[model samples]
Target: MLAIGLEGSANKLGVGIIQHPDRSSLEHNKSVTIISNIRHTFHAPPGEGFLPKDTAKHHRTWVALLVAQAMEEAGVTVDDIACICYTKGPGMGAPLTSVAIAARTLATLWGKELVGVNHCVGHIEMGRAITKADNPVVLYVSGGNTQVIAYASQRYRIFGEALDIAVGNCLDRFARTLNIPNDPAPGYNIEQMAKKGRHLVELPYTVKGMDCSFAGILSSIDLHAERLHKDGKRWTDPETQQPITREDLCFSLQETVYAMLVEITERAMAHVGSQQVLIVGGVGSNERLQEMMGHMARDRGGSVFATDERFCIDNGIMIAHAGLLAYKTGFTTKLSDSTVTQRFRTDEVFIKWRD
Candidate 1:
């Protein structure tokens, strides 16, 4: 079976095709193959996250081109596709709507079934398939989400998340505050800085049970910048050295926030008694995070699995793979049920098929 997956929930427009063998012996709930995955990101302004309307415009203009290219890369035709899937939100509405419309139009034209999959599920499923870490605690940190999850009753359940801003947003804002180059993602720039910096400035660390709050940490950094400006200390000038540098701040921020995630995920693992840990989403690309998780897992005699950019970060292949599973289980949403939502809980999804 060939399936096309559409992911336009944020700044990315991903189109992926997956081919699955017909095996009646295999359970419907089993994860399957990924044929070819392709993704195209829309242009966003520096010092800002994705804007809903602007992203929507990019989707409408560029989705067809991207999907066509993906199809070409996969060496498949539209007629060969058995089903199409699209991200049905917990994301910005405009981009979600754009992808939804594209998927709907294509499904109608081809007379194929359309599956609406959750954005977070796509992330975790992609990570799981690539790593083969079943029943592992998941730390899914990205631009729009910071969540700790575990599989339960055939669905993934989020045990902890940010009450305010996501960890990625906090990092991006901090990168912007320092006038850091925002191209190629702020996290990349911050990671470079953390490697260079020696000083470690203490930052606020807050974790209430499984939930975290980043707004206070962001405000603290802003206040620190104001103090530096008032003291007439310029990082650019070598003579006027400040007690804290942007590099140190970036390092501290990463250390503090990621520690919180590790603690909460560890707690979830204890609760679930799962030995495997999987880190998904864009921030999972950070080597520091992977190292930290690896160390923690080693301490517990458990293994931590993380995806490379090919699967760890957002891509079309994961979405297509997830959509195929959902389709195999006869799990689908009607066109009317594909409404965009900003905050859909992960545990709210009911898994229909169990092996």
Candidate 2:
């Protein structure tokens, strides 16, 4: 069977086609294949973030072209698709609504069923499928979400999460403070800068038991940057008495925030008695974050599983993979029920396909 998925939960608008083999042809529990995955992001200028209205307009403008290109690349006609899948919630409301409307129109135009997928669940399922990490502790970190999740009693239980802004959001806003380019992505540019850093600046580290907070950390970093920019007071290492650069600040922020994420993920692993860890979402693609998670997982005699940018960042393929799982379990979203939301919790979706 085949599925066409649409994803526009944020700045990126994606269209993907996926194929699922029949039960007889499936092997080793691996049966899903990505036919094509195409995406275009709405890039905002430096020191600015993408607004929902503009992002929605971008999605509305490119969704059709993307879908057409995806289908052409996949060499599949609409008649070959079993369902049309789309992200339903936990994202910017305008972008989500725009994508949902496109999905509804496609479903009606092609006479196919519609599957509404949870944005977070799509990441988890895609991570599990690509890494083959069965029942691993999941750390989902993206622009809008930071969560430590695990499967228990047919639910992806949220063990820990951000109390305020997400880790990626913190990083993106910090990049804005430095007037870093948003092309490709703000986080990617920050990571590149952090690689060149040698000093680690002290910042607020707020972790309340399992959950972590980034709003205070972001504020502290922004204040420091402002002071450095306005006063021209050289930020120097207190011990080395050496000047600190913006790269150092980016490095320090990544280290501090990623450490909090690793700490909470470790706690969740201990709570669930699972050593295996699977990192998902856009922030999960950071090499530094992955290395830290690897260290933590190895300490527990386990391992870390993560995907490349193709699956890590927001894409339609994850939605197709996750939605197909739900569709096989007799799930469908009616036209009337295809509403979008900005706060869909991960645990709200019942994992009917998992044991």
Q: Which candidate is the best by lDDT?
A: 2
* Model 1 / residue 131 / CA error / Å: 0.5
Question: What are the per-residue Cα lDDT tens digits for candidate 1 across 1-355?
Answer: 8889998878878888887676232342244666678877775566566678988999899889988888888888878887889888778889889999999988888888888888888888777767777678999998889999888787778899999999988888877777676667778889988986665656689999999999899888777666555665423323435366666677778888889888998999899998999999888999999898888888988999988877766677767777777787777778777666776777776655433
lDDT agreement with native, every candidate: 0.80, 0.92
lDDT of 2 by residue, 101-187 (tens): 999999999989999999999999989889999789999999999999999998999999999999999999999999999999999
- TM-score of predicted structure 2: 0.97
Error of 1 at 271 (Å): 1.2
| Per-residue error (Å), model 1, residue 218 | 1.1
